[model samples]
Structures are given as structure tokens and as C-alpha cells.
Target chain A: MHLSTSIWVWIAAFFTLAIFSFLYKDNPFYRFAESVFVGSSAAFAFLNLWFFDVKPKLWDPIAKGNILYVIIPLILSILMLTRFIPKIKWLSRWAIAFTVGMGAGLGITGMIQGYLVPQLKGTFLPLWVPGNLATTVNNWLLVFGTIFTITYFYFSKPIKGKFGVAAKIGIIFIMVAFGASFGYTIMARVSLLIGRVYFLLHTWLGMV
Target chain B: MKREIPLLITFIAGFLIVVALFIPHPPFNKIEETFNSWYIIVAGFTFILGIDSLILHNWEKIRRRSEGWPFALTVILSFFITLIWGIVSGVRTGHIFSTNSTFRNYFYLYIYVPLQATMFAILSFFIASAAYRAFRARTLNATLLLLTASIVMLGRVPLGNVALIPVISIAVLMLLWVLVDELKYVTSPTQRLIYIGIAVVAVVAAFPITKFLYHNLSPVTDWIMNVPQMAAKRGLFIGLALGGIAVSLRIILGIEQSYMS
Candidate 1:
């Protein structure tokens, strides 16, 4: 008979307990769970690659008689294997260079499209609204905050007069945002920990 | 011949693929997709390399009878066992770890969900600890932080306001006070000047800014995030991408001996 779904559930709960035990104290259970995680993840990654990528994308295509199909990948893959070779180890540079070059080119293009044009455009928001002090005040604050913060990042010249003051205020806003991000990140990580605990308690020990 | 030709091919092929984006051809797209698939295969191999390094590092520690030897052994053993199990299952026709096998059920139930949840769960205690420190309210900034944090925390839970209106109102008042008249007292004159100048400069620099129509609590906050914030993020992102490229190039080219070493 196929492994029942319940077995999987039970196994999960056990690992959860294993992880949660860490909060109490770093112990054997946590170590066991962490180890299993690494091993399983590695094994799964390899299997999935063999199943999905190397098999269909490379191996299958090559076998189908596209003699030219195998050349580059085969060479690259073999070159990659050269790490095992003691003397001719430098051959792996080609693969690295190719990957890096492409990645850099993609990043350069993305940076322009993603950041520069959009930010400069935001500074021009309409601040004056008829009989809407709250909206007007909010817009003014945003405009002020964005400018100063950007200025704070730019250290080309000494900030003087009004610009310096605004930049300080802008720093506060940025800090607040960063704090929120940190809080949220902590929440996410903690939640994961709790999940492991809950799994251990409910599934492994059967104690709610 | 093998080495020089490959390097030349690397430079030429890399440039061509990048320039290929400007070309509106189906083959260009296909080549991009092929590269993506290759990335997955390479990533898998990288994972193996990582595990190997981990094992090697841990093995040395264990052999020397250092601290945490048990943990190291546990890691190495688990890795080998899992590999053996998966391989055995994959080789067997109807085995559970076979392709699209039921092992995924085990992975999902026993591993992924629990790990994810546990990671999130650990935050509760940390939040409580942070709240203790940040909510002390010794200073005006501290007070503001406490108020916003309390509001947000309460907002996260259902019936927060209904159950704790007094607390919520107190926090809201603190926020309002800071935002209004209190801001002048707290913000230094130099800072104020910077704020005004920035406001003026931002207005002047508005052209060529990306406009995003998205929902948010504050329009001003959204605008800042979408525009200048996005720009800053993009700059960092570009740097990160370039770094990734450099690292990848180092590895693929075998110029980087750290991994192999």
C-alpha cells in the first residue's frame, strides 16, 4: 500500500517538535530536525534537477540527434567537471565568465528601467488643493520627506540651511520604515519557529 | 585550443545574448529560455557542492573531536541517508520517492509546512521582547515608536480596536500629536530647512518619475515608495544583480577557487 498521507503528517509534526525544542534550549531534537532538512533538501534538489532539467532540457534533446545541441553544454558541463582535475582546473573560467557577463548585462538594463526614471518623476506631485488642508499637508510632508532623504544619500556637497534640516527629517522617516521592515521580518521568522513547535506538540507528543 | 576558444566564445556569446534582447526574434526568446533551464541545472549542482562543503567542513571538525561533532555527524548522516533513500526510491518502479512520487507528501507535510510555520512562530517571543524595549516611552521618539507599533500589532489581531479601544486611541493620539504641532519642537531647524528644500527639489524633479496607481493607506507614502524609494531600491538591486553576475562568472569561469578549494 502507498504511504498514507497520515504518515507524512505525523513525520511533519515530529520535525516541528524537533525545531521548537530549540526555543527551550538548543538540543538533540533541533539538531536532528535541522540535519534532516539539509539532507532532504539537497537530495530533493538533485533529484528534481535530474528529473526536470538535465533529462528533458539537455539529455533528451541531445539524444534526439541534434549533434550540434550537445556541443556547448557538453563542453561546459565537462569543463565544470574540471574542478575535480588538479592540473587543468583553470578551464572552468569560461563557464563562470559567461554566466557573470550575462547576469551583469541583465542587471544594468533592469537598474535603469526600475529605479532612476520613476523616482525623479515622483517629486512633481501637485501640492495645492482647494479647501483640503489634510491632503495638502500630507502631500507637502511626502514631498519634503522624499527630497531630504534623497539628498541625505547624496554626499556630493554639504547640506546647508533648509536642505540640511529636511534631510534629517527625511532620515527619521527612512529609519521608521526600516524599523517596520525589521519588525515584519522578525515576525515572519518567529512564525516559522512557532509552526515547528506546534507541529511537534500536536503531532509528535500529541499534546495539543 | 579548448581554453582560448571557450573564453572567446564566452565573451562573444555573452555579448550576443544580451544584445539579442533588442532583436525581436523567436529564437532569441528560445535561447533565453534555454539559459533559464541551464541555470536550474547549474543551481542543482551548486546545491550538491554546498552540501559537499558542509560535509567536508563538518567531517574535519568531527574527526578532530571538536565541539558540535554530534551535530556535524547528524548532518552528514542525514544527507547520505536521504540521498540513498531517494535514489533507491527513484530506481524502483512503484516506490514512493519515484518521479512525482508520494515523497512530496512527506516533504510538504513533515518538512516544508512545519519549517515555514516554525520560522514564523519564533517571532512572537522576539516581538514581545522588542515591545518591552521599544515601548518604554522614555523619550518622544520612543513614544511615537510605541504608539505606531502598538497600533500595528493590535491591527494585526482581530477585534483589536473593539477589545482595546483605549490603548488604540492613546497610540493614535500620540501619532497625531507628533505629526502636527509636536513635529516643529522635535525636528531641528537644519532638518526643517532640508525638508523644505527637498520638497522643492522633488517637485522640480517630478518629470520622468514612474507613476504607479496602487492602493495604500497613505497616498504620500505610496508616492514616495513608488518613486524615489523605488529608485533607491533599483540602484541597490542593480548592484546586487551585478554582484550576482560577477559571482556567477567567477564560478562558471572557474576563476573562483573558493568553492572548489
Candidate 2:
């Protein structure tokens, strides 16, 4: 039982245990740890934003007398704070309008280029390869799977007979895919568990 | 006038961004980049709103001596401690009132990281407990899902694959046999023909040599992932893209003003 002599390790271990104590039941220790976590993270984000973004990009440039480009965004940012004032809250809508407009615009182009075009291009697989039977079969399955899955989500008309069968096949494919995703998710969570355990054993107790 | 102006702004911004994608002209190309820079500036300033909300909520709790008011106090203390430490110590080094690294590293590493990690790690236990209850095979679809999930989970870990290898080999052999046998019983001529072709292919692939090839659970899981999972994901991506474009259009056309409210 070679426990860590370092106070930092002890502190980390205590907090880790405090959080894990929620499994037994939520307690003051857990609440204290959770509060500290939330506060510190919020503070960290604030500091990082100020230092990395506002300081370098907005503040320094304006301070250096490069005010022409920075002025519009500065005004927009101050306008955003008008949300706090009840009478002037409507003024903040302009800032929201600008940001949301820009976001929507960028999002549309991004979705087309990044997702729509690429995914459409991906569906164009050659079903009949000369020698590669496995590859050929896989491609055929993929094409049918994609078509049927998309058809399942089609809501304009009633699905019956062939379309119904196709949708059923699509459901099967979706279920299997969901199952695979669930398994992977479980693995991810378990990996986090392994990490915490490793920290406790190796870092705190020297028990690796 | 207020509503119309914002809608017009949305239209102009969205249209220009979309148009900028095709235009190679320097000014048009810079529009998106300029918008992005403004977004960052606006987003950076909005952090104050979030901090103010947190402070107000916690302060009210503290003032009322509400349930878990001590926790609220801890939150406020930790926030200021971290804020002051980061500001005074230059975020990376120089301590103001104290010279030791205690104020800086202790709060971040000891409290924050451990708390975050342990919080996430606790989910593993909950998921495991949930899985135990959820993985029952009461129907054909449920059984298929369970089987696939079992294969994937087992395939991901070393021990599970070792246990699954022989089981998978047997299952594949059984599937091939079932495909062949089912070919004889179908009524429709077209279905029979398709079944025959599949059976023939399965027979050829079901050779003893193929047993050596699929001696692990990985190939089965990989096949399921590559064929079914990839197809479903692509379908979803396409659907999401279409939906996103529609929403963008709605916002741009002033049909969606819910965001402003």
C-alpha cells in the first residue's frame, strides 16, 4: 500500500472519490466537488476566451489604432449585452440577427459541400467488379441499404408491398447499425472507467 | 420595421455566404472569413452573460440560505479563486499575492479534472446496469439486434473475441446451410432463382479454407459496420443535410423568426 506522498495526488484522489460517491448516493462531498468543477471550468473558459481571443484579436488590434475593421464587431458585441436591459432588449435582436444569419448562411454552404455532395458521391459505388465477389456483394448491399433507409424516412406517400418490404429491410439495417453504435458507446464509457481506475491505482497508490 | 430589418439582414448574410462559396473573387471570398471573425468577437463577449447568470443564480441561493447554500458558496469561492489566480498569475506563471504554484495547479488539476473524469466514469456503471436490463431477446428484431451488439462488444475486447471465434465460425456455417436449404422451399420462381444464386455463392464461400479466414469476431463486426452501419450513417447524413438546408432557407427567407424572440 504505497500511497502517494504528494498532496496534489491526494487532493485529486479525494475529489475523484467524492464524485464516485454519487454511485452509492449523492452527498455533500459530491456536491462540493461538482460545484468546484463547474466553477473552475466556467472560469477556465472565461480566462481562455479573454486571453486567446478578445485580447489578441479584438483588444490589441483596436489598442494599436487599427480601429476601422474592429469597430463594427465591437459595436455588435456591445449591442449583444443589451439583452440584460429590459427596455433595450429588442436592440439585442440585431446582434442575434447578424450572428444567426451568418451561422445559417455558413451552415447551408457547409452542409452542401461537406455532407450532401460527399454523401451523394459516396453512394455511387460500382456494384459489379470483375473478380472481387465480396467487394461486389458489399457494394450491392450498401447501395440497396442506403436507398431503402432513405425510403423509410419518406413521409409523403403510404408505403405498401415493395416499398413496405424495402422499409422493413431498412429498419433491420438501422437496428444493426444502432446496436453497433451502442456497443462502441459502452466501450467508450468503460475506457473512461479504466482511466479513472488507472489514476487511482498508478498515480495515487503506486499499485500498477 | 424592427422585424423586417433583421429578416433582410438574415437574407443578405445567408445569400452572400452561399454565393461566396462559388465566387473566386477576393472580396467575395473574404466575406465568410470576415463574418467568422465577427462571430468570434460576439461569442467572446457573450461569455460575460453566461458568467453573470451563474453568479446571479448562485448569489440568490446564498442570500436565501437555500438548500445546498454551502455548495453555492463553494461555487462562488471556487469561481473567484480560479478567476483571481488566472488573472494575477498571468494565466501561465507569475503569482501576485502568493509565490507558490499551489493556487494555480491545485484547483485545476486536483478539483476540476478529477471531478470531470469521475463524473463521466460513473456513467459506465449506469450503462452496464442499463444494458443488463435492456439486452433481452424477446422478438426476432430484438434477437438480431442483441446478436449484432454482442458480436460488436465482444469483438472490441480481446477476451470476448477469444470466446466468440468458434461461435462465429459455427454461426456462419449454419447461416450458409440455412440459405441453401431455404432455397428449395420458396414458391415464387423469381425468388427461387435469387435464392439459388445466393445459395451457390454461399456454398462456394463456405469452404473449409474460409474457416481459417474468419477465426476471429473482428471480420463479422467489421462487415456489419462497413455494410449496414456505413449505409445507415450515409442515409442519415443525407437526410440531415437536406433538413439543414431547408432550415437555412427558412431562416434566410424570414420564415423562421423564432431565433430572434
Candidate 3:
């Protein structure tokens, strides 16, 4: 049987086995692998930001003829690094505030444009479909399911009678949704586990 | 100025972008574009703060000779080593992720991806434990969940529909058993009749349903996903978006000052 001779493949196998070893118990190998994962991930993120975000957005304009335009952001970015200095740490707040504001701004606009509007548009379906029983049923379910789900979250007043019934229906829909989500999440993790196992077998050990 | 400046900055940045949405005029659109770019730059710099914290935390642990300090050292060493190699290689190749770069080919592909995927893969075991906690499988909700989750996981396997029969049986039986047990609390004859009626209906309906599912399990899964899941997801998304917009407005209005601290 052909075995993987590559050192990198061996390294990957070791790390994979090392991580899997945690399933039995946390030991030195597992600890080392875990730490390396953290450290290397951080480094990778650092390199990515520098190359993709910082270099192009911050450094390039300054190096080019657009220094006048980039001066503000440059100053703000430098200010962000001032958190290391205790005396002038407050100055970093300016930069932090900018990011927070931008996030808040994007949150509002994005929610409206990306999520809320589209969802509402999707939900506003005609309950009746001409000569299509399944479509008609699905439209009714969508309309009622959405309305009921929203009613479940409505906490301004005490729910009772018909309203309570609608809220109960909402809870059923929510639980079903959560159940499906849980199943899907577990399946996704299972797929990842399968991929690792496949790599260990076919790539590393040449065992199908 | 410490508090006021941040609050003011958050307000101005948030407010202007929202205004730019409604009025995409020359200055407004330009301001939105500039602010967006600046946001990306500033956010990128925030990673430095994250790395700084990680390094300092591990460094302090190492200095103190804390338990697992060697692992911390491993962290620091790997971080710096990877960082240095990446930067040097980036300088050499004009990019850190160049096709020929060892950082990408060996370290990233071999080391980082394997570690990352393994780490996530390890969670499947934890998720199994979690499923034990989650799916007690007595109530209709739990039974439905168990059935759907099993369907999803096994839907792609050969004879997948064959595998699903037992699961559906178990789930249906558990649900029926739960209803049967609830009869003790139901002193009313009509309520007891309702329970028995449901069980009988379930027992009778199981035949055709199982027949359909024995061949159409994948289609059933697709229907569950497309119809109920999407409907619920849409509802949740709408609610979340509305809530997010409210909070965002509060931040822009400077009422949400928690970020300032």
C-alpha cells in the first residue's frame, strides 16, 4: 500500500490525531496542537488584514497621490494603536467610536435593505393560487406562519384567547425551525469529521 | 472629551450613513464611500489589538510560570514564526498568499486548514453529547426534531430511506407513548377520547406515510427545509432586522453609550 511520504502530510496527520486525542483525554499533544491552532490562526488573520485591508485601504492611498484624502483615516488608524499607551488611551476611543458608529450605521441600513424589506416582501404572498393546491397551501402557511411567529414575540400585552392560540401556533413553528436548524448544524459538523477521516485514510494511509 | 468624543463620533458616522441612504447626493454619497473605506481600515487595525491581547496574555502566563505555560509558549512561538514567515514571504513574492509561496502551499494548506477543520470536526463529538442533552425524544417537538435531524444526516446514504423507517417508528411511538401517559392527568372523558383518537389516527396514518417516505425521504426532507424552515427563518429574520434597526438607531442617537466605555 502506498503511504504518504510528504513531511507536510505527516505534520497534518499528527495535528489531526493530536486534536482527535482530546476526545479521549486532554494530554500534552492535544494541548500543543490546540495552542498552535490559536497562535497560527491569529498570525494568519494578521497577515490577511495587512495584505487585504490595511495595505490596500490605508497604505496604498498614502503612497499614491491621494495622501490628502487618506490623512484622516491614517490618523484614526494610528490612534487605534494607542491603546497600548495608558496615558493617551482615551485618544483611541475616537477610532473605536468610528468603527462602532459604522457598524451601527450598517446595521440599520443593512437590516432594512438586506433583511427586513426582503423578508416582508417574501411573506406578502397571495393566499390563493389559481389551480395550484400546493402553492395555495404553501402561501397560506407562509402568511399564517410569519404572522403567528411575530405574534409569539409580541410581549407588549398579555396573550389570551384567539391571540394566545396564534401565539401557541407560533411556538410550534419556532420549535420545528429550531429542530431543523439543530439537525442541519450537526450534519455540517459530521461532514467536516468525515472529510478529516477521508484525508487520514486516502491521503495519509492510502486506505480506502 | 473622553466620553463625548466617542459618542459624537459614533453618532455622526451612524447618522451620516443613514442619511446617505435616503439622500444619495454628491457629498452624501462621497461621505458614505469614504466612511465605509475608513471603517474597513480602522476595523483591520483592530486585529492588532486582538493579537496584542493574545500575545500579552500568553506572555504573562509564561512569565508567571503558570500551568500550561509551555503550551502558551508554543502559542507565542508559532504566532511569531508564522507571522515572520508570512511577512518575509509576502515581501519576496509580492503577496503573502502567492501561488508559489510556502506559507500558502505548506503552512496554510497543510497546517492551518487541517488544524482548523479538525478543530471544527472535533465539535461533532461535542455536538453528539449535546444532542444527547437536546433530544430526550418524548414530546412531539423532540420527536419531530429527532426525525428531521436523522433524515437530514442520512438523506444522502444508500438505502437512506430504509434507515429512516426505524427512526420514524421510534419517534412516532415515543410521541404516542407520551400522549398515552398524559391520560392520567386528563380526568375528562372527552380529553381521554381525544388522546386515544390521536394515537389511533397516528397508527393508521403511519402506513401510507411510511410507504411514501420509504421511497421519497429526500423529497420529504426537501419539503421540511423549503417550506416550514424557510417560513420560520423568514419570520425570525424580519424580527431580528427590526430589533437591530432599533438598536442601531439608539446608537446613532447616542442613547446607547455602552460602546463608549
- In terms of lDDT, the best-performing candidate is 3
DockQ of each: 0.26, 0.60, 0.77
lDDT of 1 by residue, B142-228 (tens): 544444444344444555444344553454455455445544664687766665565555445432221221122234334444443
The CA lDDT at B192 in model 2 is 81
Q: Which stretches of candidate 2 lie over 4 Å from their true place?
A: B46-48, B91-104, B165-214
Best by DockQ: 3
DockQ of predicted model 3: 0.77
Q: What's chain A's TM-score in each predicted model?
A: 0.77, 0.94, 0.94
DockQ of 2: 0.60
Q: List the residue pairs that clash in candidate 2.
A: none
As a whole number from 0 to 100, the lDDT of residue A177 in candidate 1 is 49
Local distance difference test, per candidate? 0.57, 0.81, 0.86
- Native-to-model Cα distance after best TM-score fit, residue B228 in candidate 2, in Å: 1.5
In angstroms and one decimal each, the interface RMSD of every candidate reads 4.6, 2.1, 1.4
Shift of residue B91 alpha carbon in model 1, Å? 4.8
Model 2 CAPRI rating: medium
lDDT of 3 by residue, A1-208 (tens): 5799999999999999999999999899999999999998888888988899878886787788788888888899889889888799889989999998999998888888777777788888988889999999988888888888888885666789998998888877777788778778887888999999999999999888
